[model samples]
Target: MAEGEEVKNKQVLFRNYIDGFPKESDMYISTGNTIRLKLPQGSNGVLVKNLVLSCDPFMLFLMRKSDDSGLFGCYTPDSPITGYGVAKILDSGNPKFQKGDLVWGMPGITACAGFYVVSTPKKGETVFVSAASGGVGQLVGQLAKYFPEGIDIYFENVGGKMLNAAILNMRNHGRFSAFDYLVHYSQFYDILLPFIREGKIVYIEDVTEGLEKTPAALVGLFSGRNIGKQMIVVSRE
Candidate 1:
């Protein structure tokens, strides 16, 4: 295929603005769209073919209608819902990325960095990380291993009872680092590079194949039905 050629794009669309917990019905797959295979002229964007789409809890907040107080805008009805994903670049106008480059990160958002600055874990200090099994939580747990004391950090994804228990177990002057799903941490890659290269972290993914299963994959995150990081496989290659 020639570069810049247009092709049919199967997309997962957000049906409407959600108020409470989002259901599978809140999203739908649409096949009537097509996109250019190349980036726009003078644009610095990279065109990617999504291979895996992450279903995260933070997406629930983006499903809501944009309010004055919210920092991230809501997903538009009848448009493709966006999130972090693993993708293969098809074409690129961006200098940093090139065709066939495999990448994963949230689009249009600053790459998460600076976790080391705020929550520098001290050796032997007890740390408690909420949502430990989820995507972010899983990383936090693995990263905690870098501290002189391993497994001292209490990590779990479920809230409510878990939060209460974590708090009750807090030691004197225990520093609590609260992670907001909406906030992206700077220096994220910098902190994880060594761990990733060393294979110190193991990633568990709950993958649902096809765009049609995207809605269910996302909804499963809320019901605790997914065993690991929930994701939808849009394409294998």
Candidate 2:
């Protein structure tokens, strides 16, 4: 940044709730730059200049009006949207922040917004973030490494190919467990399923989108446990 450069504003708009897979038509873009540079005096809020933004599948859940209240219910029609964004303070009302300080949080848009008004807190140590390469993932990962204990992760980061190799090498009768949010169905079938059978791997499946494809992908992994079938929809509205 240079001295005396004019600041610009951007707004992201919702294109309407989408069905099945999302496409470019599912979102709209709005242009604007006159964001308030400060919060009103006596108000406990901070005005931020946003930095990085993230796009994640969880965002899809927020788009539907019929979604559960756990989703973003306060979002109104026609308002410029918000989400997770890293920002620098343009002004603040709390002692935790000052002008030009960098901060990160759950932006109004959940992890994709341009600016957010929220309390600034100092997050503590040794955080393990999933999808460390992604926008939000990367931020948390970097923040972890910044701490005193500092990102003492068992595994730093792994790509698809490397992860596949690791699973394939597991000993027979080995068990592997992962969170439901880890990967999408298309990816699991194409990558993890084969390794499960080849490594005689025992695991569980909780992801839903791959339900229809489960039988086939499982058949390919014949050695894994075939019973105790549970298809729990952990949080589907």
Q: Worst 10-residue stretch by lDDT in candidate 1?
A: 107-116
Overall local distance difference test of candidate 2: 0.41
Candidate 2 segments exceeding 4 Å error = 1-8, 69-77, 105-237
Which 10-residue window in model 2 sums to the lowest lDDT? 110-119
* Count of steric clashes across candidates, in order: 12, 9
The digit string of per-residue lDDT tens for model 2 on 142-205 reads: 3423443333221223234433433434334333323222223344344544755698545433
* Alpha carbon deviation, residue 109, candidate 2 (Å): 19
Candidate 2, TM-score vs. the true structure?
A: 0.42
Which RMSD does model 2 reach against the true structure?
19.1
Q: Note the residue pairs that clash in candidate 2.
A: 82-109, 83-109, 83-110, 83-111, 83-112, 83-113, 84-110, 84-111, 84-112
lDDT of 1 by residue, 130-207 (tens): 654544444433442444343334444456665555555655455544444345434455557677689986767788
Off-target runs (Cα >4 Å) in candidate 1 are 1-4, 40-44, 66-71, 106-115, 134-159, 181-187
